[model samples]
Target: MKINDYLSHEELKRLISALLVVLGFISIAAFFGFTVVPGLRYQAYTTGESQVQAVQGETGWLDPTEYPVMAKEVIPPIDPKTVMTPNPALMARGKALFAQNCATCHGPEGLGDGAAGKGLTPHPRNFTANAGWKNGTKLEDIYKTLDEGIKGSSMVSYNYLPKKDRMALAHVVQSLGAFDHGASDPKALANLEKLFASAGEVIPNRIPVSRAVTVLCREYAEAHPQPTATTLR
Candidate 1:
């Protein structure tokens, strides 16, 4: 029998219709499995994990207060006896250093009223007043301040200064009438002297302000001296 003769048209149509229905069901199942099911599962898993972590308090965030605070280093005191023999040379060097590095904020007389001082809060310490907020008038205290800066203040560490130079600066600061408003304290002076001695050899005079002054005076006198008149009889 021929194929067309054996199969009836109505029967063939029914078979085709059944095959299409099965393919349609397979396509719908495939779309759900590849797209919708995975997305729903992921959302549910993530939400559940987040909720569990919140309930357990296991979010892994650290508290700031858990860290320990460290204390500042303390500096040693100096012997007063050795630093009293005022080294004019060191003072002069320190004066120059102050002019270059400190005058802008501390003023020419260290009054803490320089042009820049107008803008600063808790205005720069008036060294002339010698009101040391950090306390301890020891030379080491000054040196430590120069080595390690004070926080929340304009006072910064001048670690770049050599030990001798720092000592000179301390001495210069001390000499500014701030440390000696009345009679010099014998003990304090002696301790300062000893501190200077311990800091190795004294700083030598390097600046020549006097020589410059002398030259200027000689030039001025030669150019504009008062004339002595000889009267003709």
Candidate 2:
């Protein structure tokens, strides 16, 4: 009953073979559960028609106004030869404008690291650091930015400003001493002069208040066709 009674070799072999079969089945089941099945489920979830339907439904009723206009106009070069000298008076005004509108994100010194700038994701431009994203030392580039803001960024159009005022602000920005282009390239200066000269002539005139008022009254009358005379008065 001692050693020989433990198990016959053939009996032990049969028991081991049965155990191997059970282990193989468990391994196969585990592989399918952990990898194949989950992958298939994920593919079905992502590639199903329901995904397209959900996207369509979400965007179908979007208003036209919800989409931003991405159009950009061609910009003219800043005439370096005709570059007006920095006017201290205009710079003072520009500084006030900067404080009122830009100081929140661009610091009081135009360093682009104001108090509010800290929370922004991409961060603001540090003007004092001399790292301009839209390059060119010409004042025209700065004017273009002020007129038609940089896209995909927080910079916005300041088109409400008069042309002269915008030019003044550009000068003030340049006066920060970061920009130091010596002189306008001779070729660029000649080209700018030619462009300006070839441009259509603009007539300067002032309409009388009486005539302007009449035109406005006529427009209002046309819009509200049946309005009483008292409404116009």
Q: List model 1 lDDT by residue over 52-122, tens digit each.
A: 11111110112011111122332344444333444766576666666645666677788887775667666
Tell me the TM-score of each prediction against the true structure: 0.41, 0.43
What digit string (tens of lDDT, one per residue) describes model 2 on residues 139-179?
A: 66666676676675556565544344455667766666466
Write down the lDDT of every candidate, Cα atoms only: 0.49, 0.48
* lDDT score, candidate 1: 0.49
Worst 10 residues of 2 by lDDT: 55-64
Clash number for every model? 14, 0
Off by over 4 Å in 1: 1-85, 130-132, 178-233
Best candidate according to TM-score: 2
TM-score attained by model 1: 0.41
Tell me the lDDT of candidate 2: 0.48
